[model samples]
Target: MAVLTTTVLRLEKSRRTTKKLKDNVVAYGFLAGGLICFGLFSWYPAFRALVLAFQQTNSVDEPTWVGLENFRLLFGDPEFVAAWRNTFYFTGLALVIGFLVPFALAVLLNELRHAKAFFRLAVYLPVMIPPVVTALLWKWFYDPGPGLFNEVLRFLHLPTSDWTNSTNTALISLVLVATWANLGGTVLIYLAALQGIPGELYEAAELDGASVWQRIRHVTIPQTRFVMLMLLLLQIVATMQVFTEPYIMTGGGPEDATITVLYLIYKYAFVYLDYGSACALSAMLLAFLGVFSALYLRLTREAT
Candidate 1:
């Protein structure tokens, strides 16, 4: 009788183990296609880019290992310095204008008790348009003669200025176009974050005689600090890689005033046929962004 009981228990355990193994096999089968695609498209390309950074290749001949020659050439170029400076300036200007406007708009939209849907739609409408379309639309608006902006200025009897045509204002013009096109997404994100804030906090602040600004400073900002930090980092990363606005609108013209690092990389690879230097520059940008992302993650984690 004891032997029979032991045999039955062993059979049940064996059945459970087999079932578990079969389930795992099914799960792995489902994941296999996605894993293969990721390896082929993402991982392999990334590894190749890294390898290309170290070798000089024109795609027609035997590749030569150039070591640090590409980096040396990139750093010594005057346009490289100018490109970094311009990129930084664009990023800074973008942060000053683009970053705060969306948050402010979100806060204002949050306070509205009527026409909320309409307002939200208005804010997010620009994001629905294709980036190329937005760039072309703004390019027309920036035209000195029949441009909408200059026409408005002319009607108001104000001096109409050369926008993207001049080196003085080309970068700023691009920044404005970029800010207008991109802020819709940020506004929506901020609005979502604002909505997630508990109403009780505002009530408590009001009970303590906090003014509107005081409530926002003490309660609203503190509650949404995490979202703000994350968005700020994202904005930095996005602005650093800015290419489309300058590429489509300015063409990095007006004495290279609007040139960015990414634009420079594109020129190096395609225009100059120097893939090695382009790859090296890309590697550097990737490394910098990776470090920035790591620090951002660590800081956010600690703050949380």
Candidate 2:
């Protein structure tokens, strides 16, 4: 009887092992295609970019290794410092003008009891428009003479000023256009975060005799702090990579006032035909952003 029981137990264990192996094989089969696609498309290109950063290529011959020469040339360029300065300036201006506006609009929109969907759609309509179209449209609006903005200023008896034509306002003009075009997406994201907040918190705040601002300061801000922080990082990154507005609208003109890092990168690759320098700059930008991301993650983790 003991020998028979041992034989049955062995049979059961073997069956279970076979079932587990089959299940693992099936799971791997499902994952294989996506893994291959990511390796081929994403990982391979990233690795190639890293390799290319140290090499010189003209797209007609074999790439020659230049070590740090490309980086040295990039650092020596006059526009390098200006590009970074302008990029930081744009980022700061964007934070000042763009960041808080969306959150404020979101909070206001959240309080609205009627036509909420219509208001949301109206705000987001600009974001759906093509960037090129937005640039062209805003370029016309910024025209020094007879432009929409100037006309409005004229009607209001205010002094007309050069919008994009002057070095003084070129960067700010680009920022305004950028803020208008991009505000919708952030507003929607903030609105979504606001909606996720529990109503009971707001009720408790009101019961404590908190005013609107007090409720927002204590309840709303705390509840959406994570989303706000994440969006702030994203906005900083986006503003740092700004190229299209300055490219299409100002052409980095008005004494290079609107020249940004990405715009400089574009000029290196296309205008100067210096792909190596462009790649080197790209690698540097990637490293900086990587550090920023790591720091942000560490800070957020510690806070939590």
Candidate 3:
């Protein structure tokens, strides 16, 4: 019987090999097309960016290779350093405040006994607003003199605060706007993950007399760990690359307090006409995110 099974397996393998060889032309044709497109857009551009990072361009004419001058200047540049600091600070703040809120909100939304669609829509409505419009609206809200924030403070006799203008609060203010803008998407993601969890797990936990918190701590969290990691990594990348809010609202101003990584890159490329330095900065950002993504992938693979 064992010899017969081995013979059958060999026969199947031979048949499969023959079929694949017969279709080799079509397979190789598709592979060639894929490689061409990938090279044209992804691979070639990536290599070109690295090349340009080592070269100088005045935004016209041929680029001149300048070796490591761009990287050296980038490291020594004061504005670049400040932008780096602010960008990391924003990412840290958002990771803490932005990461947990949406998950909690999603869990709450999932538990809704009535008006579920209304609650979902209400939470997601702000995300539908154009980013520029959202930035402008927040600018109005955070306005020191006549803004709603200060007005509310005065009504409640709380101390009035300079939100966007004050260096101490500008980054936090931007984080608030980011959290508000992104909460809906995060909530939706968590909702889907939460719903994907099998009902039988909860039933078994309940039968074991597990309290609600106990069940959530053990079952809910473990089941959704993959989704949590995905969202966390995505937030890290997105928050690290933040530019639009500061660009539109502060102009990297209030004493350059709100300038972020991509903001610095923008200044290098467009404002300062140093495309080389900009590419170098971009490469650094890519390196940072690559490390994060690699770690996540390793952890995920090990778990599975």
Candidate 4:
């Protein structure tokens, strides 16, 4: 009787072990599918691009290893330097305008007592619109003749100015469009961060006779610093890759004033059929962004 009982317990244990192993295999099988997809679509492309950066290739002929020749040609090009400068300038402008507007809008929205949902929806509506559509809409808005913006100015008896037509205004006009279109999502994120802040902190600030701006400076900013920093990094990285706006709006026009690194990359790859140069430029951008992110995160982590 004892031997039979022990044998029954052993069989049950064996069955449980087999079930656990089967479950793990099933989970790993699903995970493997996702890994395979990423390997094919993401990792492989990145690796291929990196390899092509060092090799002369048109995707037809056998690629010849050129080793830094593409990069040398890239650096020698005046437009390459101009693209970097323009990208940095755009990033700075975006940080100044795009970075602040969303936070301010979020704060205003958070303070409103009624119709909060309506305001939030209004703020986020632009985000739902396709980026290409947004760019097209802004292109019309920036048109000098019979454009909505110029019309508004004329209606107010103000002088109509060149928007995307002149080099002076072209880059900044695109910046404005980008800020308006992208600010919606940033505002919503700030709003979420604001909501997560403990209400009691605001109450304490009020009790201490802190004014609105003071409360925001002393309490709100500190609480949301992490979110702000993260968004700052993301914004810089994103603005550095400003392609769509230039592509759709300015086409890197007005003497290449609005040309950015990514747009230049596009020109290299598609227009000039210089895939090697394009890949080299992409590698440079990737390296810069990777280093910047790492350093920024380390500094921010230490500060916090």
On TM-score, the candidate that comes out on top is 4
lDDT of model 3, residue 44: 91
Q: Report RMSD (Å) for each prediction in the order shown.
A: 1.5, 2.2, 4.8, 1.5
Ranking by TM-score, best first?
A: 4, 1, 2, 3
Model 2 agreement with the true structure over 37-82: per-residue lDDT tens digits: 9999989987787887899976577889999989989889889998
lDDT of 3 by residue, 169-246 (tens): 999999999989888989999999999999999999999999988988998899998889888889988999998899
lDDT by residue for model 1 over 1-304, one digit each (tens)?
9999999999999999999999999999999999999999999988888888988987577679999999999999988998889999999999999999999999999999999999999988989999999999999999999999999999999999899999999999999988998888999898889999999999999999999999889988888888888888999999999999889998888899999999999999898888889989989989989998998899788665
In candidate 1, stretches whose alpha carbon ends up further than 4 angstroms from where it belongs are none
Each candidate's number of clashing pairs is 0, 0, 0, 0
lDDT of each: 0.92, 0.92, 0.91, 0.95
Against the hidden reference, what TM-scores do the models get? Answer: 0.95, 0.91, 0.85, 0.96
**Candidate 1 local distance difference test against the native:** 0.92
Against the true structure, candidate 2 reaches a TM-score of 0.91
Candidate 1's error at 187, in angstroms? 1.5
Better of 2 and 3 by lDDT: 2
Cα displacement (Å) at residue 240, model 4: 1.1
Winner on lDDT (1 vs 4): 4
